[model samples]
Target: MTDVVQNGQAKRVSNSAIFAGCAVFVAGMVGAAYASVPLYRLFCQVTGYNGTTQRVEQYSEKILDRTIQVTFDANISSGLNWEFKPARMVNPKIGETIQIEYTATNRSPRPTTGSAVFNVTPMEAGAYFNKVECFCFTEQTLQPGETVKMPVVFYVDPEIAKADETRNIKTITLSYTFYPSEPGKPVAALPEGNKAVDKKL
Candidate 1:
């Protein structure tokens, strides 16, 4: 009877240990699942994988003699009643900073808000496409029938002409998509009474 009691206690402890181990593993997996998205995004931003462009505060260090045709593309998510378009194209000397603009008009009778997400094409060249200033990542709200112009100042890094993966690339396309913002979300602080307009842009 003494030996049996000891075995039963040991068995219970073993079972408890197994359950605790499984619980810890599940918790870890759940945490990892939650972190995967931001981690992947950071990874993409760092490596310029999947056409994720780089954001820079200052102008390029140098400008190359060769010019590259940079094109613009715009898109609006469904349910957002807005007309969005970008200037067709511009040729800028490598590393030359230039500003291009996009126009957005709210067609709905009621006010609406939106946020823009952007990316670059020729995924390999994304690493060299840099934005000095952009209206993206900000909530934009528009009054009924309002039109506004948004600007993006950007430059192609001169390193594009030297990187083995991007050398010989002649064109890069930047694209944006606007999605409707959820109600009750914070609106961007615009100058009082600016209808879909940003003076800084």
Candidate 2:
């Protein structure tokens, strides 16, 4: 009887250990699923995969005479009540930095915050498009009936003219879509001393 009881106790302990191991495995999988999105985004940004452009502090001083036409597109998702558009189309020489403004107006009666997701096309051109400064880098908040002008600084890498796939590409379109931020996330506050312009569209 003593031997039988000892065996039973050992079996119970083994079972508990197995159950704990399974629980830990499941928890790890859940954590990995949550982390995958940001990890993939980081990977794309670094490799310029999927038309994701690279962010740069500055470009080379040499400007190639090859020019490319850049078109801008702005969109607001279903829940965001705002009017957005690019100021104009621009054509710039490769490696020459250019700045442009986008205007957005909040039509809602209450403060609204938005974050933008952007991409460049055609896909091959993404690896060559570099942005120095862009509004898409941060979340934007607009007060009721407020209108704001945002700027983007960018350049086409001169190396693009050497890439056989994109060398002859004449135009690239940069598109941005604004969406409501996730719930409970902190909304970025507007810069101090900048009064909201109550210009409703």
Candidate 3:
């Protein structure tokens, strides 16, 4: 009787351990799946500052009377291997549409595909800005030694020009960086916006 009871207790302990392990595994899988989308988005935003989501705005324009023309600049960081350029630096007037063009070449021997994300920090009135052409949202693939010209079309809102906070604004900077694509992932594509005759480079 004692032997049988002992064996039964041992079997119950083993079964409990197995059940707990299975539950933990299932919970982990569920948590991972639930967090995947948000995690991916966070990664993209941090890596490139894609400017898809709106950020908190803090505008100050105490120098409205100063001689300053709102200018836009570009910055390319390290770790991303490519050549880049800007089509325009200073937009003449509010609501004026301008194109910023850049050429990217794959420096590595292997075919490369990745997304270019950007951030625009304009003077106080920059929030009224609208982008008509943007490659930042789409993933681009380049064969070795191949180069492609990318364009971003944007206009500053007229309201910004009239705003008290932006009256003295002189420049806005748009910066971008690229990152490697995950293996076996489908290329992410974004629809192109309003078309303009871009100077073929």
Candidate 4:
């Protein structure tokens, strides 16, 4: 009888260990996907983790013969009534500098200010992505119906071609999401399917 009890206890412990392993595996799979912005600023700016692009001043020293398509995407989080978008796409050679623009207009009846957070993908590409000039994190205040153009200057590092993890990338996407510059409000993920709104008052 004691042997039977001991065997049952061992089986229960084994099952508990299996369950804990499964939980850990699931958590690992979901690592930082929900961390969104600010995390990019705090933990990713230097290391470029979670697809956060690096900021630099000088242009790349070496331009490559290879070209990669760079795409742009924009989003507006809640509490901001602004329309923003990039100026389409460009295929830039590795280490070659390029400049692009994004237009933003206040759609609200009153003046509003917004800030931007940016990142790039296939996650690992962040370490190789470099931006020279950007309007991110700056407060832009526009009067009612006021529109303004913002430019971004950036390039992909030539070292990307040599890095084993990013060498195969053919396309990279640079994305930004704008949020209200209201003090004390926490930044959050953008809502789906609402890039441009007819919410003009």
Top lDDT hit: 1
lDDT of 4 by residue, 150-187 (tens): 87788999999998999999999999988887643434
Scored by TM-score, the top model is 2
RMSD from true fold, candidate 4? 9.1
lDDT of each: 0.82, 0.81, 0.57, 0.80
TM-score of each: 0.83, 0.87, 0.56, 0.71
Q: What is the overall TM-score of model 4 with all chains considered together?
A: 0.71
**Which pairs of residues clash in candidate 2, taking residues 3 or more apart in a chain or in different chains?**
none
Between the candidate structures 2 and 4, which one is better when assessed by TM-score?
2
**How many residue pairs clash per model?**
0, 0, 6, 0
- Looking at model 3, the pairs that clash are 69-170, 70-170, 70-171, 71-170, 71-171, 71-172
Please write out the lDDT profile of model 2 over residues 48-124, one tens digit for every residue: 77888878777668799778999998999999999998758899999999988889989999998887788889978
| Model 1 stretches with alpha carbons more than 4 Å out | 183-201
What range of 10 consecutive residues in model 3 has the weakest lDDT sum?
A: 53-62
RMSD of each: 4.8, 4.7, 7.5, 9.1
In the range 9-86, model 1's lDDT, one tens digit per residue, is: 999999999999999999999999977776776777777888888777688878888999999999999999999988
**Per-residue CA lDDT of candidate 3, range 27-125, in tens?**
999999877766766654333234332221232322222333334344445655666665555644555555667667777787777665555564234
Best-to-worst ranking by lDDT: 1, 2, 4, 3
Residue 56 in model 4: shift from native, Å?
0.7
Better of 1 and 2 by TM-score: 2
